[model samples]
Target: MRDTAKAFGEGPAASIYAGFADLVSIGTCIAEWHAAVVAATSDADRFLRAAKEKASIWLKEYAGREHLLALGEIAANVSSVSTSDDGKAVLSKLAKQPLPLGIFASHPKERPIFDGDHRSVGKEKPKLAVAFVEFTIDGRPVADIQHMAPNVTHDLELHIRISRWPEKAERLVLTPLSVESATLYQLPTFKVSAPSGDPPFTFSVRERAVFSVPQSFFSRPLEFKYGAEFQPLSVEQPVEVVGQRTLRLESVDWQRNPQTGYANIDQRILRIRDELRRWPTVSQDERAICLKLLVNLAKHVGQAVQDNVFPGVWSEGQFQIEVRKALRNDPSIGSALQEHPRSAGGIGDLMFQGVPIELKVETNRTLALEDCKKFIKQTTSYAVGNGKRIGILCVLDTSPKVNPPFPMEEGIGILFREADGYVLPVVTILIQGNLTPPSHFSR
Candidate 1:
């Protein structure tokens, strides 16, 4: 027999790194990676170099890699030097914006909130105010609009005011929240005076300082383009009359783990748990339903493993059948539709309240992370086809050499995916199969 201690660190470490890289690209571990990188050092230059290198590598692999690479390039070339106190204040303000360095100057303009057909007349426009019905922290709701962390519960009361109320406004459906950062130049061109000397000279300087501002105040509310639903108010007040809402917003930054000096999964989860509430659209009940499904699935997974239910080779169909059976047996989930045909092309493995559920059984000796991502995308397509805007992907891991089993809490996650111009939240559940009994392994 070989020394177990010596064997611990051996085998496919590179593959594991690649797997995590894939996860980060898909926004599965973005908050963790971002927090890690930001907290790694206080020197901005070091941060830029490391971020640039990583972004450069990721851009080649992930087609939908966000603006990090381009932003890195812009930030690297430009040196932020403040000659005056005003300039220092500008730099301080820029640091708070989502994209501190600003997106590329040549990047295409952002899509307008209202199209030509939906434009408001003159100064008349719809006003929206969000009041938190239930928040994790007192008053202020965490706003991780990207959904990079764990569960986000939004219990909100949305107050909408407009010049004209909808004729058929029994039900109000609000959109998901999207983020936009705006960069403005203080001055286009200015005359610059040379340094004091016997013969002082002046010249023209066309470049001006750019200041980025997060659209959180008035221009940009946490409102998405589509999907999240809201109910209209039942008050007897007139359409034009609306109550005022005041919220004191505060941001939580840099919660690092004691040992790692980086934010862990739980910390990231806690920091953003109440984020959805700020959007004013996501209902607490809807989130509770999804959470219930996930929690129950997790419990069933643990119990099934304990019972040694999955031990041999199983096909995707076989796995789906068994999973559906398990869910059906549970009194909570009475039944679920199987192999449900969608309006767009292929069929989904399961359907619950129109939400697509795609099941996969991995038979390979080594599970590739790319394959995992493909499994998610498959479910996302189904959800988009069915017009659910949400999906559940259950990947049953049955590899023989499965080491370092996925964590119960960390194993389950919700990641955002863009489909047909809308951001869809996809919940991923990893179900491990063919596990050795706990008594069989030495501590």
Candidate 2:
């Protein structure tokens, strides 16, 4: 059970798996239990004699009519077994005899401690890291390499799926590299059947590593999260890989900034911050925090489009509720409030850290410049009412048209609104709706 819990994060089914180590452990425990029982009982012969006398006294005082009848029957059957009769014949006759109800009520049934249902239980799978290692042809590191295909400059991509975690440490150790097409695997050079004594490869977080690969080594394209044309070695591979480690989490100092070398910061929270850096804004520090909270919203909506989750066109308010759920579901942005009341009487669609976010949906069509202008004004009002300079406006383009996806920078823009002789920018981010699948494009 311990091994099962370690391997598959399940404990209840461990009893079915009786390995050599489990038998040895069980034997040792049983031996110790027998020793303890003997010590407690002192002399076994004396203990049995006293137990028999106590049973006789209990039978004499409280034996009911049915109990007395069962005792008489058992005694007569035993007496019938003469010294001349065979042992097998006497045992067979005793087994065939019908016994009275509750005949063994005087003594409790002895059961092994491990046989109880309270022994173990299944546990939820632990949050393990999903890692992907990519090697380029030109030795230049590329961002979002998992989504991109192997072009002239870029070559083969090797993905390693590792399940084991080191004890007491949070590091995700990638197992040895393997390419099924090739015979041998080497850590350095990334070539199959390389010379022996190649140094092992080590990976670090937020750092890049370059490796040399032989020409024409990787002819076939490797599989990706969205690109399912290339089959994976195993079905248990993660859809996407993020360089995050499952460390023993400790209490964090909430007052301190995570960017300033805080040790106890969650990697997922840091990942949101990393996504915020890619967002185009003038005040990256102040306005960017709002984008961090919206990262899950954008991704969730984007995935829904990719997976064709929506059955029909949803209302603007419905989109608002869904976006609110997406943000709230994220542990990093669990405090996102929906329909927060503004000081100027009306309620903002959503509020996070005193900033208001307005949501809009364009039914059956994509969002245009005019659509953003109308919504930005409303979002700006909510921001100014809440005593803030910047606000966010998210428009869900629920268009049924099969349009090409827009780049992140193109979908996001800053619209300036002047109030009280001061200019404030409302970050308008457009989420593309009803996008055609990549497979459809191939057809």
lDDT: which candidate is best? 2
Model 1, residue 167: distance off in Å is 58
Clashing pairs in 2: none
lDDT of 2: 0.46
Q: Compose the digit string of candidate 1's lDDT tens values, residues 1-443.
A: 02221222333332233323332332322233333333331232433344345544544553443433433333332233222332233334334324222222343233355556796434433433222222222223424332111122222323332333333334433332223222221212212222333321222122222223222111112222212222444522233222232222222233321211223433333332344333222334434444445544555455544465677667888888887876677676666544555646886677766666788888776453334666777877887686565577787777674354444345456666665666766667666677666655555
Q: In model 1, how many backbone clashes occur?
A: 1
Off by over 4 Å in 1: 1-289, 304-307, 335-339, 365-371, 402-404, 419-421, 437-443
True lDDT of residue 401, candidate 2? 59
Tens-digit lDDT track for model 2 on 145-216?
Answer: 221221113343344333333223323323332322232112222222212232332332222222233222
